[model samples]
Target: MNYFSHNPLNRFSEIRPDTAKMGELWRHEQARVLVVSNNLSLLQAEAREAAFLQQQEAVALANQAEVRVYLGSEGEVPYFALGFAGLPPALLPEAYELHDLRQVALQLPQEQSALLAYARGMVHWNLRHLYCPDCGSLTYSTAAGHVRQCSSEACNKHHFPRTDTAIIVLISEGDACLLGRQKVWQPGMYAVIAGFLEPGETLEQAVAREAEEETGVSLQSIAYHSSQPWPFPSSIMVGFQAVAVNRELQVNYDEMEDARWFTREQIVAGLQNGTLRMPPQFSISFRLIRDWFNQTGAYKLEELVSA
Candidate 1:
């Protein structure tokens, strides 16, 4: 599974509407809160793990939070997420730090990373939707922070959490796959072609569009691979493997720094010599490349990269 895919918490959707039940869960002995501020997650500074606060410690903080969400529960233990408008309540400065979730995701345990991703998404949504778009009125959190309702009685519109959907595809032709790097990315880092899905377009169509726009490669056959929850302000990255119709390249300088077709042998040589750097292992991009690289069983992508 991708890093943030397998969330074990049972998000009790039915119970979200039960305010009394949610309050009870919030006060439960095992209830814990994950605090988020400006999209950064709270972490134990030395341990490099998620900093989950006990109920007593969180109660005062929760009262000042702009948004509080009932994340879900594990058996009897309930999990909640709190989003602060400004700086979150301070823990011991040396003991806790606010870190970008992306930077610390790999260091944390898988389940903790997934749980924090979930919290981040909810907090982001609630914070952004503090006002109703339609009614131009202030909104209030409801449905355990899964929804927002306009305060205006005349335009009481309900808003739900939303995630932007994007397609990331590895365009392959025989022994080679297409990869590209953006100028803002780290030096020597390259990954698959990806872009947001346009309104009214199918996922396959989005894949085809992104490939042509970014790398000028037309796809022959596109197949669904998998998906990963990218909660950097809430987005779901849908993965795909597509066959290139041709090897022709016309890099869009506006969208990409460079695009190229790389054979398996070239990838191995690049990794061995420190010239090529693949995406992080936790990402679907790495999975796409790994699966394609190991198709023949002659070379192990993971071993080559690690070594």
Candidate 2:
């Protein structure tokens, strides 16, 4: 499974509308809260695990939270997320430290990482949509932070959480796959072609378009591979495998620093000699490359990189 896709919570949408029941669950003995400040997750300083506070310990901090979200439940234990513009006064610096989710995701347990990703996405949406787009009025969180309603009696617009969809594809022709690197990325690191899905476009269309625009590699065929819930500020990545029509490269200087077709042997040599680097193992980009390389049975991508 993808890193953030292993969520076990049963998000009971039916019970969100019942304020009394939601409130009861919030105060339940098994209730736990995850805190977010400035889009960074709170982690225990020593253990590096998500800092899940008991309901009693979090009530004071929750009162000051700008976004309070009920992140569903696992059996009888309800999970919630609290977002603040800055660190709450109740937390001590020595006990907890804020870390970017992307940086620490691999270090944390899979389940905790997934839960934190869920919480981060909800908090990001709420914080960004604090005001109504329909009318210039402040909005208040309702439906357990799943919704924001305009405070204006005239507008009364209801807004839900938003997730941007992106298509990431591995474009291959014969024995090689296409990869590109942005100048801003880590030195020597390259990844698959990816772009946000434009309105009025299908996923396959987006994949083909991104490949052509970024690397000038036209696709002959495109196939769905897999998907991953990427919560680096809320986005779902749709993965695909595409066949390229030609090997000619017309690198879009504005979009990427370099783009090239890499054979399995070339990838192994690059990683071994320290001249090339792949994306983090937790990301869909790495998965796409790993799967492609492993298909040949000549080398295991994981063992090559680790060695």
Candidate 3:
């Protein structure tokens, strides 16, 4: 998804749009990327070798194999790219670990292109989620890399790749937008109001509810903008513009230290000076906030998760 963000994501007939199409493309060249696992006691240096040696069952043909995705390499390092046909059977019992794609992406060098990030992340998801919850049997990669189907002849359940759907909104009244900061945020860093989408809720509903719940401000109108695939463990952030008919700051210490309105002048200073830390440039939120400000002033439309 990040790969398509730059290129003709739609133009590439080879690229899959949603989870289904995407997985189809991934399985065709699915490679195993390793994340140091708890079993290995990766915190210790000596433990890794023994863990690797012990994981005979999982590494049948993996070792001595060209590490396709090297921790440090020009191309991908030594990693097993498995096919839907014999993956789980090839990898079990050994304790060799697998990590979610998002976690892996976090550790990668900033220079690593988004394409590698996407490929590695997607494959990792397939590797970790190899079984169906319904039948409790192993599920094989399917629909290319987009899905996993239970091997049980009877249950036949299908599991698709999942991305957390959240709505991040620019709640504005006049020349100001609502912003807040998590206690964990970089000092002085503040960004748009956001929250996950609960079941039975639409993006607009989520936005309105989050604004009300987080800041006790009721939104009058909601406008859908764009989206971004946040592989911070796989979330797709949908962006929105909500007009706040009133100005009110509410604090919910459990989630945020504070919530309040930021006039256009305040945001402009924050962006240019970095005196106020913004979300990484790679994040849609940064772009969203940036674009919004640029357009008469806030984040861009495409800065949303979907766009």
Which 10-residue span in candidate 3 carries the lowest summed lDDT? 38-47
- Per-model lDDT: 0.90, 0.90, 0.56
TM-score per candidate, chains pooled: 0.96, 0.97, 0.63
Better of 1 and 3 by lDDT: 1
Q: List model 2 lDDT by residue over 1-307, tens digit each.
A: 8889888899998888789988999999999999989889988985469898889978887878888999999999999999987875656334778889899888899899999999999999999997899998999989998999999999999999888999999888888999999999999999999999999999998998898889888889999999999878879999999999989999999999999999998999899999999999899999999999899957899888778
lDDT tens digits, residue span 1-307, model 1: 8889878899999999999999999999899889888888888975478998989888777778888999999898999998875763453234778888887777889999999999999998998888899979999989999999999999999999999999999999988999999898888888989999999999999999999998888988999999999988889999999999889999999999999999999998899899999998888999999999999757799998889
Please give the lDDT score at residue 66 for candidate 3. 21
Give the best candidate by TM-score: 2
Error of 2 at 249 (Å): 0.9
Q: Between 1 and 2, whose TM-score is larger? A: 2
TM-score of 1: 0.96
